[model samples]
Target: MKYYSTNAKAPLATLHEAVVKGLASDSGLYMPEYLYKLSADFFDSIQNLPFNEIAKIVATAFFGEDVEQKALDEIVDDTLQFDCPVVEVSDNIYSLELFHGPTLAFKDVGGRFMARLLQYFIRKEGKEEVNVLVATSGDTGSAVANGFLGVDGIHVYVLYPKGKVSKIQESQFTTLGKNITAIEVNGVFDDCQALVKKAFMDEELNRHMKLTSANSINVARFLPQSFYYFNAYARMKAAGKADNLVVCVPSGNFGNITAGLFGREMGLPIKRFIAANNANDVFFKYLQTGKYTPMASIQTIANAMDVGNPSNFARVYDMFDGDLQKIRSVVSGATYSDEQIRETMKSCFDSNGYILDPHGACGYRALEEGLTDGETGVFLETAHPAKFKETVESAIGAEVEIPERLAAFMRGEKKSVEMSADFDSFKNFLMTR
Candidate 1:
């Protein structure tokens, strides 16, 4: 399938090109030219299908024509070796636990899928050493780093804001010595993201080193995230709780929610979406006043949702055909303060005995406030609570035993290049190295 840029200036690109090029030449995010809707029969059988089986069906819609079914299925299977089960937290709200992966974050699915798909294209095209430039608030760095770790022909550079990421989150990327390099930027998440974008658009740097983004601006990373939404719907369908189902996503750069919106376009039977926000509430403010405004990000316990100027807002705008009213009708917005997130996290633990990472707390709270009677809600518990060890422990006043996976990460010494957020410093670092 062909893809078009949200900016509407770049020529349409094939799926492979969109995956490799990441951001369009016009500095716009790439979107599919057409959304392939699933058949009624597929939804009818969705309840019985395994996670990878259902993932293959959905992945085929965007990638089947471009990739052979066998190869595509293998990619889907490899990407989804872990489970994403929906657990009932209450009578009306269910938590789609997505942290059962190597990185203990929901971005693992997208990161792994993108890694395999990009590697396939690299081998097919006989390209040499494509450097992946990714900026993470918290989880994206670890997810992308671990997903692409030791994969041939691709080197990943994870740029994250210094001191903003959790200790385990930073360790997951920084500890891996080969093929993954972590750059600690002395700024916020947006600054790190800006450095990635500037490097992509830099003519001199592009000539010296082949660069692409693993951020959600890349079609490969964001589109594969739609898998969880389908899986969530299928599970809900099986339980006969699909009626008036609302899916709540913790929003940051808006990539995750944008992918869910794609699932809705493909007839996923979702009633609506709730874009949950932390301190960086640009989208929430937009939903309130119907005006788009961006500012600096504020630090919150839910660090992953701290994007002031989300890169993928353009994609969501394009997805609904630039119709604000149409967008508002299908999706709702809610914001939570650090205090509210803490309260929700503590309350859920006290009530349901379920631990929530700060990001998941925002999602769960949004559903609690927004969902009406008879409307069952599924909030995405985006990561394992132990990933945010200190914050979660402080909120709940309980010691969380570190899992073996996280303990392994914590044991390694940190190794990261420190840099200012300036593009010149970033560009010079890339050009020199």
Candidate 2:
């Protein structure tokens, strides 16, 4: 499949080139040239199909032309070892529990898929060491780090804001030493993201060493995320609640929602979407006034959604052809403060006895206010609440049991490199490495 840059200036890239280059030469996010719509038969029998089957069908649409059927199926099977079950939280409302994977977050699917796909290409082309640069606020670092951990011929560098991520989130990435290196940037999530983008754009750095991003800006990383959307729809259809299905995503870099939008274009039977945001409400403001405005990020309990200038806004804008009204018609926006997030978490636990991570709280609360009668709402419970144990326990006045997976990470000692947010400093560090 041919992939084009959203910027429209860079040359079109093949699947291998797009996955390797990550960002286009024009500094635009790569998007597939065509979207393959699923057959009516697929949707008709979707309720009977398992998650792996649903994901394989969707993955085939995105990658079948470039990759062999056996390889693609293996990648899908390996990536989705766990299911994203849709559990009912209240009447007409459900939570798509996506934290059942190895990293205990929704990103595990994308992160693992990207890692395996990249390794496939590396082996195919006989390439030398490929460095993966990923910037994360919370869960993404751990997901990508653990996904690429100890994988031969690839090294992952996780750049995260210092003192901004949860302790558990930090431990997940920083504790892993093999092939995964954590860099603590002395700034916000946006700064770390900027460093990754700049490194991709730097001529000398790219020439010196092969650098690719594991962030959602990469086509491979974001496109596979569409798999879960199809899987979620299949589960909802099985439960006889597929009519007027509204999926709420807690927005950060906007990649997750963009992937869902791609699914919608490919005929995923989604009624609409809601992008829930924290205090950093740039996308919310854009939905309100039809003006795209970005600002500095604010530190909140939902740290993952704290991206102020989301990198994937380019893809979202390009996907809608920069039509604000059309984008608004399909997708709505909602924003909440830290206090509001806490209130939602506390209230949901008190009322439904369902614990929500701060990020998922934004999604659940958005559905609570946005869903109309007869519309089935499925909000993404993006991560395990135990990852944010302190905040969740304080909000609900109860202790959260740390999962054994998370406890293992906490048990490991942290090892990381500290760096400033300056692009030059980042560039120099990479050039030396």
Candidate 3:
């Protein structure tokens, strides 16, 4: 299927071009030309299939025209090595646990899927080395860095705000010394994201080396996220709790929630969506006032959602044809302060014996407040709480055990190149490399 630029200024691009280019020439995120809705029979029997099987059906719908059946199946199998299970957090409220992957964060699905898809295209076309530029507030760096680690003919550059990410998150990316390079930017996550966007738009940098982004701006990265939404729906359906199904996402760059929106378009039967935010509530404010105003991000315990200007907002706006009423009808927004996030985390653990990462806390609180009668809400538990050990411990007032996989990352020695968030500095660094 062809993909069009959200800006509508660029020519139509094939799946290959969309996947490799990452961003449209017009500096807008890519959107699929058409959405392939699932058949009614598929949804009826969806619960019987395994996670990867459900994903393959969805992946084929989105990619079958471009990718061969066998190859696409292989990619789906390789990418989803872990399951995102739906666990009960409370009555009529479930948590889609998405932290069971290698990096133990939600982006693992997109990160790993993008890595394999890019590698497939590179190998198929015999293309030269492709450089992946990803800016992470926290988990994205680790997820993308580790996803492309040691892959042949590809190098991943992870730019992250210095001293802003959790120590565990930092260790996950900075320690990987293979094809992954972590850049510690002396600025906020927004500045790091700006540097990436500028690098993509710079002609000199493009000429110096092929550049693409793994951020949600890339169709390859975010589109695969819809897989789990289908899987989550199937799980809910199996549990007979699919009625008035509401999915809440702890949104940051808005890629995660945008993917969910796409699933709804493909007829996933999601009743509606709630975008949960921390203090950096640009999207939240936009929902309230129907005005989008980007500002500098504010740091909170849920650092992953610390996006001041979510890049995927362009895709969301374009998807809804710039209609605020249409967007509002399908999606709602909620914001929480750090104090609220902490309180929700503590209260949930106290009552349900379920620990939530700070990001997930925002989603849980939103569902708790926003769910109407007869609605079953599923908030995405986007990351493992152990990723934020200190913060979780303080909130729950108990020791949090670090998973062995995360503990292994902590043991690896840190290695990173410190750079300013200035575009010139980033350009020179890339050119020099």
Candidate 4:
């Protein structure tokens, strides 16, 4: 399967090349030149298969012969060591709990899989080493840092918005040493993402360091994320509840929702995808008005989705052949304010006895507002509520227990370098690292 840039200027590339190059020379997100739709039989075959087997089928569609089935199985087995539990929060409304991984966020699945896939590609090409440059609003940094930490031939540098991420989220990336390094940008998530994109486009930097990305902009990150959509569907099928289902995803950079669309293309029986976003909802506005205008990101409790202009919009637009009407038909976008998010959290707890973080609350709100009757919707609990304990507890009037894994992290020392969002500062830091 060859991939082409959405900008239509760069040459088509195989999956490995797309993974390695990340952003195309034209500064466009890499999309498959052709998408092979899965047949009904293909979906039925994996309905009862193990997670690893299902992952192989889903992954091989994009990876093709570049990655062997055995290799893909190992990568899946290693990456998905935890469960993505689907719990019923209310009647016909379920929460896909995706925070059971090392980083306690949904990005762990993609981050870990991308790290392993990159390792495989580097080995196949006989490359000595590669450096992964990632930008995170909150979860991606820790997920990338932990996933590639201590890998033999890869080093990860994570850039995050300073004073924007949660304390635990910050500690998760900054505390890890060895192959992982964290740089705090004195700006929003967009600034950090812009710097990373600029670095990838910088030919001089490419000569000095083989720059790869673990951001959602990377095809590697997007492909592995498609697996969980199938995983959730399979689980629903086993319980005799699989039908036209809606997935409510908390949109940040829009990569998560785009991957869900890929799964839908690969024969997943999804009715519609709801792009749940915070106050800075560029996609929401674009879906409503058919006009795309990016503004500066606004601060919100759901800081991850605080992207004013998501970098993954290029991929989303490309998926629909740049047709705004086609995108609007399949996707229903909604944005929630901080006050609305808190109210949604309170209502969900008071009504269903379930706890939700701000991001999950945004998804829940979208589902409550936009869900059609008889349509089953699953809101993605992207992060554990305990990750935002202060907010969750204050809203619900109760204390949430921290997971044992996160407890260990609270005691670790944090080590991160603070820098301005200037290219020179980032470049100088990379040179020293």
- Top lDDT prediction, candidate number: 2
Q: List the residue pairs that clash in candidate 4.
A: none
The list of candidate 2 runs beyond 4 A from truth reads none
Q: In model 4, where is the ten-residue run with the lowest total lDDT?
A: 44-53
| Candidate 1 Cα deviation (angstroms), residue 280 | 0.5
lDDT of 4 by residue, 53-117 (tens): 77777877877667887888789899989888889888888899999899899999999999999
**lDDT score, candidate 3, position 399:** 92
Off by over 4 Å in 3: none
**Best to worst by lDDT, what's the order?**
2, 3, 1, 4
Regarding lDDT, does 3 or 4 come out ahead? 3
lDDT tens readout by residue for model 1, 1-433: 8899899999999998888888999999998889899999999889999999999999999899899888899999999999999999977999999999999899999999999999999988899899999999999999999999989999999999999999989999999989998999999999999998988788889899888899988999999999999999989989999999999999999999999999999999999999999989999898888899999999999999889999999988887887889989998999999999999999999999988889999999998889998899999999999999899999998888789999999999999999999899888888777
**What TM-score does each of the candidates earn?**
0.99, 0.99, 0.99, 0.98
- Cα lDDT over the full model 3: 0.94
Which regions of candidate 1 fall more than 4 Å away from where they truly are? none
120, model 4: CA deviation in Å?
0.7
Instruction: Give the whole-model CA lDDT for all candidates, comma-separated.
Output: 0.92, 0.94, 0.94, 0.88
RMSD of each: 0.8, 0.7, 0.7, 1.2
